[model samples]
Target: MTAAQPFVQEGPDWPGLRIFATTRAGGVSAAPYASFNLGAHVGDAPGAVAANRARLRALLPSDPLWLDQVHGTRVADADHEADPAPADAAVTRVPGRVLAIMTADCLPVVIAAPEAGVLAVAHAGWRGLAGGVLENAVAAMGVPPDAGLRAWIGPAIGPLAFEVGDEVRAAFARAAEPPAGAFVPTGGHDAAGAPKWLADLPALAEQRLRAAGVATVVRSNLCTVAGNDRFYSYRKEGVTGRFATLAWLVP
Candidate 1:
């Protein structure tokens, strides 16, 4: 692992699995995107994104299955080669085929069921969360109902910084009925004096994962907006790069 190009390794509860979350540090990209922008669609130079990806590829067995994430709940099975599909999540039972999700503020989730020989990752923004991206990914893994699945919630806009309108709050409440603590009404209000609530994305994700039969769930406790020095933040910085969370079976 490159010490300067920061990445956090996920715990080893699921055997035969390797997962990592990269930070904004260490790459060839210049300003705005800066040194280590992994996302190519976010206005970063092609050469810079290529260089950054090539640098990241050194840590994995193969190139990652990059998705054209549309903030929806579609899931792609990464067992075969295909064009970047329109999906928010991906899964694979094949060893060494890396599943990657790029994000700045949206939560990146990595799921593994080593006993079942399956692994998956999702790009879960609020929209994807409300629409069941996590559930879809779990289903796509093809794990039996009795299978033990675990997940790690990666960096995103944290609760304190994620201000939202009543509609956003209502969406989660109406659909999943997540815990009250997941949606905290804050002092901040929009122009119409409508109260802005602080929504805990990780908390909501945990609830959904549990509902979808995941046995264990762990959160990274890293916030892209707050940990700006380490991760990129589209919400905090309008024009920014995207870091990635990658998971695969250890060969």
Candidate 2:
């Protein structure tokens, strides 16, 4: 889609997938959510948000089915493909149907079953991931577990920078296929005699995808916690905005 340009573009490595991750640039949002903030719930002016959506519309193959993401594992049909729905993930077999997922520190995973002519996007924060969001998405596609799904993981908080509590750790462990290193003991030693253990959200996310048979994975390794100018982190900033990673087939 032809809205704000992507910091990274489609590479020769990615086949049968049109994907890009957003940066905090080229939009008209202001203040805490300053510029290019795709999320409307984060308190940006309605007009500016609409204009930003327009920019995204112009660039995508078709109107994107934006989600009212609640950080759950509920997969639903795309807005254009069905009705305006509430779901954390979306998949499509039809061409020109874009499956877009929004994220800041959380990982946004784009899936493509090239042979089956399908694509999907999942918004997986720790809550969703712990609740089987990715597995739900793969199941929603009805592609079978061995369909050779290709995935591209977008920017998110790195494990080293992400600090979580015991509750977050318990959530994953309770999940059927828990990812390892989701959280490390964050209370060893700091430069000034402090205590902390960092989490590796990206690595954990990759492990989840790999466990689900998504062999082809491409990750940007861009950390929202570290990159303030390019990304918006709710954890980093209590009142922050969100960027998006969108994917679709060219008609």
Candidate 3:
């Protein structure tokens, strides 16, 4: 019952590189993740999804090097690779090639070393974030730990709407206790009522980036859960599609 939004941004915050995130708009995908289903592993019609990708590719530097996106810290060398690789993040120094990450609720992060001509994309789904995905990606860039890197977060489940179980809280506790604030206890109750917790994924990611030697970070105020009409949220729908967030250098 809602109208479609457009695929756009005011402008990329990453200088010397092209960076963009896909919205849940302007595509052929129908129903759940209607239009612009950038995720291939999510069970959408391959033909339709490919068509949507083709449409999206028309606006980028080149076909994006997609990832399998396991919730791990593995980083892929997609700089010149032509196929999808099993990794949580991707990095490239080659010009005209794109590195991308997709998510519905999980945070999609874009990293760039403009001076170093390095660009990367990561899927930070708490597991990946806590497991050192950002650190891995930046380290893989070979830019030296002191070389300042910049980053930006794409739309994902915001803190106000993201609730988690004790186990989830425990995961963050193992990584960094300070980020515990990203999670708010729901109160002691059952699984349905047991104290759930709200998570601020962006804040958690920023902390990781800062700790990883990244100095500049830009963030979008978009929340996938609250902006379903503009984003593709798997949590919002039982079987929804995916949108894309990409970054690349122009030849």
Best by lDDT: 1
Clashing pairs in 2: 1-59, 1-60, 2-59, 29-35, 159-199, 159-200, 186-196, 186-197, 187-196
Q: Find the candidate with the highest TM-score and give its number.
A: 1
Could you list the CA RMSD of all candidates, in the order they appear?
2.2, 4.0, 3.1
Give the per-residue lDDT digits (tens) of candidate 1, residues 144-179. 867888999988889888989987888988885778
Evaluate all candidate structures by whole-model CA lDDT and list the values in order: 0.86, 0.76, 0.80
TM-score of each: 0.93, 0.87, 0.91
- Candidate 3 has which clashing residue pairs, if any? 29-35, 187-195, 189-194, 190-194
- Candidate 1's C-alpha runs over 4 A off are 1-13
TM-score of model 1 (CA atoms): 0.93
Higher-ranked by lDDT: 2 or 3: 3
- Pairs in steric clash, model 1: none
Identify the superior model by lDDT, candidate 1 or candidate 2: 1
In model 3, which regions exceed 4 Å deviation?
1-6, 191-194
Model 3, span 175-195: residue lDDT tens: 777464788876654556656
TM-score of 2: 0.87
